[model samples]
Target: MKTKTVYCLSGLLLGLLTACQPSDSNLKNQNVALQLQQKALNSTLGYDLVESLTVEVGPRLPGTDKDIQAVNWAVNKLQSLGFDKVYREPVQVPVWHRGQAHAAVTSPYTQSLVITALGGSVATPEEGITADIVRFNSLADLKQAAPESVEGKIVFIDHKTERHQDGHGYGKTAPGRSQGAAAAAQKGAVAIVIRSIGTDSDRLAHTGMMRYQEGIKPIPAAAMSNPDADLINNMLKRSDKVTLQLFLSPESQGTATSYNVIAEVTGSSKPEEIVLIGAHLDSWDEGTGAIDDGAGVGIVTAAAKLIQDLPQKPARTIRVVLYAAEEIGLVGGKAYAKAHQHELHNHYIAAESDFGAGRIYQLDWNVNEAAVNALQQLTVEMADIGVMPGNNEASGGPDVSMLPALGVPVASLRQDGRDYFDWHHTPNDTLDKIDPAALAQNVAAYAQFAWLMAQSEIILRPVAEKQSQ
Candidate 1:
């Protein structure tokens, strides 16, 4: 009896060893394939894409001629790049034109100040508005001020944005830009000006979206360049009352047609399942939108192009979506969610590259708890490229925020955004701001992860209750 038991144990041990050998060999093969793919993506394709978008189709503000040109360009470029299917989905976008903007200190000190109208801001009268300046250290201060004190005054919300690699400072300071006008309007201020939500101290004022609440009347809102804000602060130190003249001729031209450009590399097996990668196509009219989102379009497109060049198709389709009108409030993203409500469940994974051309340092996911192991393995594979794992609380990007909210798994390849806001919405956001080598790294990282997700059979969706137990 003892001899028979010993023989059975030996057989079981041999079988287990044989099973582990193939698993190890398969892992080694996967690593080799990933490395080769990464090497191939470290090329000039990403930079060239950015250059083409910026130079050929400059400033693609939604609903404008340039916006239509950009959509057409994207469709042609994607088709030329060998995408199996390239198409455009129509989206309705609000058109706001920035005509002429100017500001000057009138009393106590006379100096021209650099300013840009915030998106959705109402225009001042033809003669413009000249009023005594009332300064608040921050939005909180402005909110606490009495209506009588703020009435008949140009309220300046002076909140300075800090620089950080993760860009948390923008969120901290951006409230003053987005809601400051409404808050000040509630306090009876004639207009509102906030220090630009930027990291640089340059004279370029960043322009972004601001909202007016339903009940509160819209007011003229603008962002003063950091240096100009400093000038205003310095002048206020010497005198109790400072006056300023402000003029902006921006106007809303009602609704206009825009498009979301989509291209796909169809899957060999589960073609219905999707791995979606996205970037916003529309940019602020201030610059070429290179660092703000042209880099993003470049990175994702280049990555998808590399995947399409692979010898065999991946298991799931890889779809690249170029969103429209992201600067004003994710107009394209919301439209997409509403249009594709039924298919949202099949979106296996989604990610967006909108930060800049900065090198990726961290990867965060909003995937199911069951897929944590798959994400951990991906991080291990990405460690060679300097990408570390981050917490699971990921927002993806501005354009794809709705995906995570709908329970579609999303990932965030966080870039070093230390200097992104400095050139974000200003004329400084040109192709010169992107580093070719950094852009290549971004492509490599995105390609590797996107390819892995496309090929793997890992279930990224949340497990059912019965399956979890």
Candidate 2:
């Protein structure tokens, strides 16, 4: 939760902020946006949608059968909710099978460990590799170490992810999980292991994407649970040397096609201009991706459903994109940028609800600074739900991060991600982690954001273009 957006709204509370409200012309829609927010706060639609998806579809890792099943579920759900249009766009995604993972300290003291293979990591030998452990405090240390210090050893990076309400710690500690293997492989290490990139003290090891260099040897990469890493650290302090045995069976199956499931509530007068909202449909196999993006799927879909119920349609289309393979590499999002290259100018704005089902506390965007003022009334309307205006510096969310650079301006309704990484990418990311009240708050913020933006006279462009002027 390091992003600080959660705690940065000190002076921007409704009346304390000045000269940021939209023009009087936009006052009519403010009432409508307020109504949408109230309706969403009382609705159980977000909780219900997530429950049905996680219970019925379970873990829908991309390229798996369940991924396709989730796609169908999304289409059916959207249509039943009476969206004007529902569709799927094909996206080719890399497929990696998580076979099995095992780790243990063989020397100093013998102890079995909980581990999970990093997504896209190569497999270890059939007999596995047992070697002396070479510990590094961070990936930078591993990169600085002499090859002689790491060769034939299991490189362990002990960088711990810090907890925050803003979820900024993940970015700081992620290099160890995403790039540690390649760094270790480059140095001739036989394998790489890192402290799980999560804040929980629980034994569930977090798993995420890791890449191999083109010409370098691909070594097995995995993450040990935080407690296991702590145990190993303690063992190192007492013993002359600690040896570890590692086994991982994950393998790549090349590429497979997945779909970005899409649904739209068409605008009454100006359907061509679109306000895009999204969440990923895929999740890691370790747990039901209930918090990672399943809640996001629920949030966006329910938000749009609320918008569609208005007596009069908004002026611009509201599009919901349930992205595919976000955990892999933002494959679906990249594909969308490519697929809709020509229509990008028509994208009024884009946003993604991928953090979790946390209460939203701030609204930020990567658009013209003037656009910020135009949406100020929106922030005021959302203030009762504890939301305030943030600066013009948001990438929206992971999947929609690509859109801002492609001429589709992006916004973020910042959720309280303080505990997001506690269960992120782990088996602990289950349905029980969600607070229905908080999830309802998210729905309210998103519904308000989407409806207000759709009906506003403001159409945002990339921030860079305006900033340069």
Candidate 3:
């Protein structure tokens, strides 16, 4: 009887041990995953890598020699970083050059005014166009003016932006800068000059792309420096008979083929799902594209390098796309959308850092309720770093605008844009403008968020699709 009892007890003990064994193994695996993630998140070398790239390969305007050099630098750097696969996918980009740009008040009183031509603007004759200036407070005002008031005259659009992080003033005031030339041309104006659509009160003008209306001839477009704009504005108050001269020589050559350098640290498990981080590789020719996008490229590259060195990879692939010709337009981004349209659905989350290098203070995500809980938890993890949640109705940066339409979720680490427009698209966008400590903070925040998202089982639902449904 005693032997039989011993046998029954031994059988029960073995069964219990078997049941507990699998649970212990799962716990160990989970712990290992946590450690690996922590290791990646706490990387120091990764931060230095990004800093080095930004400092060494300053501006990379598409189609320019600098742009090509920047691409080569990215390729070599990624290879050196030991990415499993680093490749350059060819991207056809527009080639626009900013030649000599000069603007001055030739009449009413002679004065030298600072200015820069808008991207894709046609140049004036060698002697330049001298015309009577027609000033308007807004585009609507310009439209309201009589044809004779603007005909054969340089239309001056004077507007000012109130400083804000969301760049509300820019949105309102930028129309004159973008469409002013075409708008004035329709009314028979010889050329157009607008108050620089930037916040700085200094003598530095901002340059951006200008799109001409279909069938409308492109004309000379220029932005006066803020201080110059002020001088023009004060002079206007004193007299409406301000005459101006504009001289610009912007040429558009044949298209050039560049590449959006992309590399990935593939997932150990679910490789199909992608968490993407990117920035435009192209910059305006005025200065090194440091603040505009060099910082972004650096930020994304560093973030990914940190993840790559971890003992275990995240479940979803992390892709770094250094886009080309973002400064010209979304040319590179549009091309990317077209090339990857078939796989757009696979992009789980996409974030872009295009705004100037400012301390990131808020984070907004445009995902559905399914991932809201996860993001909320993530926000709690990032609160110590001054990152807070924003509205779910986010569409990402201008470069990745098409992705949201294709069901890719988008988010933003809303950097303080208070001082961004000051140096944005200007010659002041140099490496000295970047604050290292602030950049590192940005890196830490991005690293933590990206790792958490990649590790989490939840996926961010596409905002457009979610809204439609």
- Each candidate's number of clashing pairs is 0, 8, 0
Candidate 3 lDDT (Cα, 0 to 1) = 0.76
Error of 3 at 267 (Å): 0.3
Q: Give the TM-scores of the predictions, in the order they appear.
A: 0.93, 0.94, 0.89
Candidate 1 vs 3: which has more lDDT: 1
Clashing pairs in 2: 1-164, 1-165, 1-166, 1-167, 2-167, 2-168, 164-418, 165-418
Cα lDDT of model 3 by residue, 1-469, tens digit: 0111000011122213111222343343334434433453455543465456656776666888888888898899989988877998888887888899898887778999999999888899888999988888898799788888788999889888779987667889888877788889988988898888888987888898887888877779888898998898788888878888889998888789888899898987878888888888888878777788877877778777777877778787888898988877788889888888888888888888888667778887777645554466444545556778766766677777677777778887888888888888888887777776677667766666666666654446536475423
Q: Look at candidate 2 and tell me the lDDT of residue 249.
A: 93
**Candidate 1 — worst ten consecutive residues by lDDT sum?**
1-10
lDDT of 1 at 350: 88
Candidate 1 clash pair list: none
Off by over 4 Å in 3: 1-55, 462-469
Ranking by TM-score: 2, 1, 3
Model 2 lDDT per residue over 58-113, tens place:
99899999999999999898889999999999999988999999998888899999
lDDT of each: 0.85, 0.87, 0.76
Best by TM-score, which number? 2
Task: Flag regions of model 2 displaced more than 4 Å.
Answer: 1-25, 465-469
**Please, what are the lDDT tens digits per residue for candidate 1 over residues 298-334?**
9999998888887778788999999989988999999
